[model samples]
Target: MVHVSIHSGLLCSNAAVVRSFGLAPKYEWFDTPEPSGKNEVLVDVLAAGLHPRVRSQADGSHYTRPRALPLIPGIDGVGRMANGQLVYFVAPDTSLGTFAEKAVVDLRRSVPLPETVDPVRIAAAMNPAMSSWVALRRRVDFQPGQKILVLGATGNAGQMAVQIAKLLRASQVIGAGRDSDRLKALLALGADEIVSLADEPERVAKRLGEAASEVDIVLDYLWGQPAERAMLAILTQRSDRSRKLSWVQIGSIAGPTAAVPSVALRAANFHVLGSGQGSVSTANYVAELPALVDAIAADKLQVNAVPFPLSEVETVWHALSDIKERVVFVPTQ
Candidate 1:
């Protein structure tokens, strides 16, 4: 493998190093990674979000998990280059990730951010917001005036999906989630209507059909039973079954696989697509970053984020399930 020269004086730095899967990472000193490719540059990591993707990666459960051990567990973060330029970067799937004070980032995969932007907020909001932002912007022919239903809208990413759909000029945005309070709160974030998914199967289906029968797009974050139920409800209630319905699966918070029936595909003009790492081209993801960054930088979308020092990673990791706000690790004091 190609390696770049680094000053002998700056060999190591403290990081959240994971030596094995299914365990909380340890904060310890580790060798700083060097830029190994032509377009890569060494960056001083500022903040890395503790997203579900990172958790899965750390536990070796993510589909794109790294092959080796002693890995850092951050998929993306905000960092500063030697020239003092601030940027939001996606870390490559490697042992060296963004949970450390230093990381090697491919310049092509990063977006330069305004120096005035809050690093913690940027780190917290980007990954979650990108789920729906890229899904609607890149995954399908989403148009203004189209109606949308965001499954699992109470969660972080799903909450942003509600506002993003409105930002994209959807005529109607329906938010559905298990929490009644959170579903009601989505109204202020631009959801025209809300559906509670906490009800029994029959009632949940009835509510979904009533609120989102004519929606043109569905941004599904909860895939297993919720997705299957929503699909059947919308299909059965639609006045025009031939009307196009684009279901973009961004996450599977409920479960990985959905038991979709053959009739759901054959009965109507239903199109199910996914929008994540493999589905969207890296170039496409990078291309959409500027606009997304602008929105976050300008405070167009509400971001709920909490910051914790990198040294406290182990404590934070175990307590993450109880935290609703996005937890961002600050590598520097």
Candidate 2:
């Protein structure tokens, strides 16, 4: 097999503290490895997204440790193989990652891409957008025209959840977040109502309870104080406790743990479930990518993406640090 020369954003060999990726050299050039198995295909990378999970994985703070030292830093990307089939793929767990000019992915894990969609945009939005898309469609069996609530609606994933919930034809979409200004921005993004987590616990609970009275589904990105308040609110204020309500836990941005009143769960009709790695199977997850990408391409789903060349990861590292917008590395550029 002939090897191809390529560039990649490689993580340092040793574990180190990186305050800003600007100072940490993460990109390098190396020969691409050939696809080793029948199930694998080599891809000419187009774009790779820089996400909080990527950053954490690079820094060794994520739940899943780094694949290996001197490894590439992207978990997912959009690329095309020599056969000319454009696809969006999740990189296998290996040192060679999607940040490279070339990557190897299992064929089963790859989803065919539509020509109507811009590869870079979908590459940037897919990971964040997957949470709600999967949660509502698969985990919760969400119904169209139902009322939904987004607990952490200001962040990238939360914001996408708001749009996805509306795109799914939810009759009402309520957004709640810590920042008042950011929460207000969600109203234009499809949130029918907005609640602030900045208020006192009692006040936040009251507001959330009022909203929960009509909500059929709750997409929770924050699992700490806000979730505690919202859960309590549901327990105390749900007009009809018998009404079906599904609370899908997608992220733990606020904190890893939440103190919940055991009585709340035992008494309320609300169902609490989680969505992500283990909850949703790989085949089901891959199956939904096409529709999610289609939604993005059609402009039904909106997101903020900042693109940078693979060689300029250091220069745009600070920008990537901002969770409000997604920063993508375009290797072809």
Candidate 3:
């Protein structure tokens, strides 16, 4: 059985959970009934992703408390609502796990999908798209001709940020990631330059400085010492031209926290900003999801999703937290 719900008890199905440490959670049967409330709808889960939040919550480090024991873990699902509409929904709570046959979800959190959109692709893209969209809107404010740098640029949200930057008229979009091949591959999506963050700390910092000197904005995902040092080195170097900076910090997949220099911020006149979902009001997000879908339909957006079968969820879940590509888990039976 598969899904997430706001209310308890929909016709029951077997769901999985992380029952103990170092071992995968096995499935157990549960009961569920049809949706009875005005704002709730039961959906047949078709696809979902093993997103970082899901993985962290499962691992007990997501900055939030773990769900109740015997938790059915899933936060995103593409499914059919009770009214028989094709939809995608984000369920951030673990009260109702998604690895079951079905669950009731709040109607407000669901987004109806286009007929042609693949369930797995939509499921994979939704969370990262929202994260990237919010990040771009709140963190990076680049003028049309401004140069922008995206660290961890190969990941799903990073690639989306690059596309969004170009869409919003960034003058130059430079993407730096772990893999040179992946960086090169992203150029088709409007990355003006691609560099590997593979060198030693000093070399990496110096290389980043030279690659995109006098950067106007940066969408950074890495949060460890290397990223922090590189950012400082790029901002602190002497130059006749003044470099006003804006940094939007979103994911810290690289490290828990960064060691930033307050002096560097002053020297560069940097405007460091945060781009997390915490700032986006739920109402506003609800209103914007339609527009976001339209933008995707119009080819004005792109997400680098790596599709895999639902059976490999644990494998994919672990990979999601790594500095890896965007993922889309399919019920590819």
Go through the candidates in order and give the clash count of each: 0, 0, 12
lDDT of 3 by residue, 1-333 (tens): 333333654445555557653455455555653566787777777777667666666665666546466566677778886676888777645456566567667788777887787676676666767776666554455467777888888877778778877887888999988877778887998999887888787888888888866777777888787568777677766363355777777778788788788777666677767765556666666666776666776668765567666566666555544636556555432
Write model 2 residue lDDT over 102-182, tens digit each, in one string.
788898888888766688898889999999999998998788999999988988889999999999999999999988888
Better of 2 and 3 by TM-score: 2
Task: Count clashing residue pairs in model 3.
Answer: 12
The deviation in Å at residue 256 for candidate 1 is: 1.2
Instruction: Give the better candidate number (1 or 3) by lDDT.
Output: 1
Q: Over the stretch 1-333, how does candidate 1's per-residue lDDT look in tens digits?
A: 122225555578888999989789999878778898999999889999999899888898988878699888898999999999999998876778899888899999999999999999999999999999999999989999999999999999999999999998999999999978788999999999998889798899889988899999999999998888889889988999999999999899889999887898999999999999999988999899899999999999999999999999999898987898999999873
lDDT (0 to 1) per candidate: 0.91, 0.79, 0.70
The order of the candidates by lDDT, greatest first, is 1, 2, 3
Q: Work out the TM-score per prediction.
A: 0.96, 0.88, 0.85
Summed over model 1, clashes come to: 0
TM-score for model 1? 0.96
- CA displacement after TM-score superposition, residue 25 of candidate 2 (Å): 5.8
